[model samples]
Target: MRKTDLLAALALSAAAVLPAAAADEVNVYSYRQPELIDPLFEAFTEKTGIKVNSVFLNKGMVERLKAEGRRSPADLVFTVDIGRLNELVEADVVQPVRSATLEANIPAAFRDPEGRWFALTARARVAYASKERVKDGEITTYEDFASDKWRGRICTRSGAHPYNLALTAAMIAHHGEQATEEWLRGVKANLARKPQGNDRAQVKAVWAGECDVAIGNTYYMAKMLADPEQREWAESVRIVFPTFENGGAHMNVSGVAMTRSAPNRENALKLMEFLVSDEAQRLYAELNAEYPVKPGVPPSELIRSWGEFTPDDLPLVEIARNRPAALKLVEKVDFDG
Candidate 1:
């Protein structure tokens, strides 16, 4: 062949490669707020040249995934809360991904045995109390939330919220139905006001002197320090990991799973593996302010500053399994108060 003919053939081959390169993009459905996750998305794309197209929502992703079904354009699901992840698995919207890298990065406690979903970060339902009003050694466990000293002085988000509901489920897992009911009754009697708002609001209530003790995830305290207006809300309160006295602090997860009908299965697995990789794990910590599920990955300096403690190793799937019973118990105990 002539030199000119060879050059023309090479140019045709390059043209054929362009579309596949462009198709490297992955579509994602995320329950995380965009502002919280977009930076990481940008970073992933920068590193791998795989563009990310995502839909962000605060509610109803499982139903949406069901509606989308096999025809779903979404290739991945990213969500908060083990209950939601389990719901996706039970609904058959997410399929198991057998990625050795993900299995290696995430601890057994943070992932489904079937690999349907894997947690990227962890958050604890901890106690926050007045820096001056509640002495350091005065409270050390979730059981302490029920004591009469905190009665009429505790604040919290609605028990119906997934975070609280999951924590309630953890209680059921550890103490049995009867004991959990009594504990809820005690916590209800102690409410400073009706359960309302997000975790940050609970800290605000403590700062305003509306309450002395509140329940919130450890990360919300970091959120407070990051937001100028809310930094002081966290000021008057110190985070206390409720080590359960008998077990460990109740924990929840933010995790990801592949769509049941992912069109780009190989790329989906790649993304999942990348997410659990050391570099991505560090980015997850910096951007999200939650503890990394990858055992050796350090969390944001803020999270580390909050101090470290043992996490309750309860199979998180159990919390998801008992969510319905937990919600029922919450109603029975009138935790809505």
Candidate 2:
């Protein structure tokens, strides 16, 4: 990895604050990996003279920016999941934006209502069930995990993982906290083994005959299919879009937000607007295997093959607001312990 791909640390000196040499540049603090975003940056620079200097952080983005105070070099932040985006908003490290282009490109359900964040890509939290062991329509909703039918057959990562937490948060948005709590306990009781590994690992366990079903993001299927080693895992299962009892499928996003202390405000906003452009949306599908936030910009061929379904239209802010409750519910159930 390049030196720019540094993890989160308050190690930057005053001089290090300037991510690029030129004045017409945007410094990005991103949780999205460098490889996933470098192509987009190259395209942006090619189209406009504004340079993009990005540092990828795996964790603690809100804390780092808060510690940097008004001196933080970040002009924009790109991160996965609404939970992290909400953290930036709550920390007051990022400010709301107003851009006609962005507003036009992104759907209301996908972007922050206040414009504090805009989604660049969307991923559905779908079930991966064994094609051989699980029959058609065996599981059809998020609530199905708690049923006696799936006991000791469901696999997932830690409930505290942001992805699972987001799903839990969505559950809170659809059902009240009290109901979500009971549901969590039920789901916990159904775990095939102690919740372990990444989403792919869950799918692997399913393929390995350890579980009949796993919960994971849609993009993981495309990613695993592209990898020679993981392709069999991808092929061994079928993607199943599950709904909330009262809502459609649960969805998550890879989002962008503007830093509160943007030195290159104009350039930063320009980069953000450009990210939602049709061209960037297409690249997002090609490079990241993610669905675009902009309508009419089709997903990559491999992504299209996975099929589509209606994502729950619940506004992301509602789900984001429930993150704390979701975390608390996870802890209450001792889901990971």
* Highest TM-score scorer: 2
Residue 65 miss distance in model 2 (angstroms): 1.1
Clashes (candidate 2): 0
Compute the lDDT for candidate 1.
0.83
Candidate 2: which stretches are off by over 4 Å? Answer: 1-17, 20-22
lDDT of 2 by residue, 1-337 (tens): 5433342246354237556334778888889889899999999999998889888789777877877777788888999998888888888988989989999999999998889999999999999999999998787889878888888989999999999999999999888899899999999888899998999999999999999899999989978988999999999999999999888999899999998888888988888888899999999767888899899999988888777788899999999989999999999999998
Q: Give lDDT tens digits, candidate 1, residues 174-193.
A: 88899989999999999989
Least accurate stretch of 10 residues (summed lDDT) in model 1?
13-22
lDDT of 1 at 260: 82
lDDT of the structure predicted as candidate 2: 0.88
Best by lDDT: 2
lDDT of each: 0.83, 0.88
Estimated TM-score per prediction? Answer: 0.91, 0.94
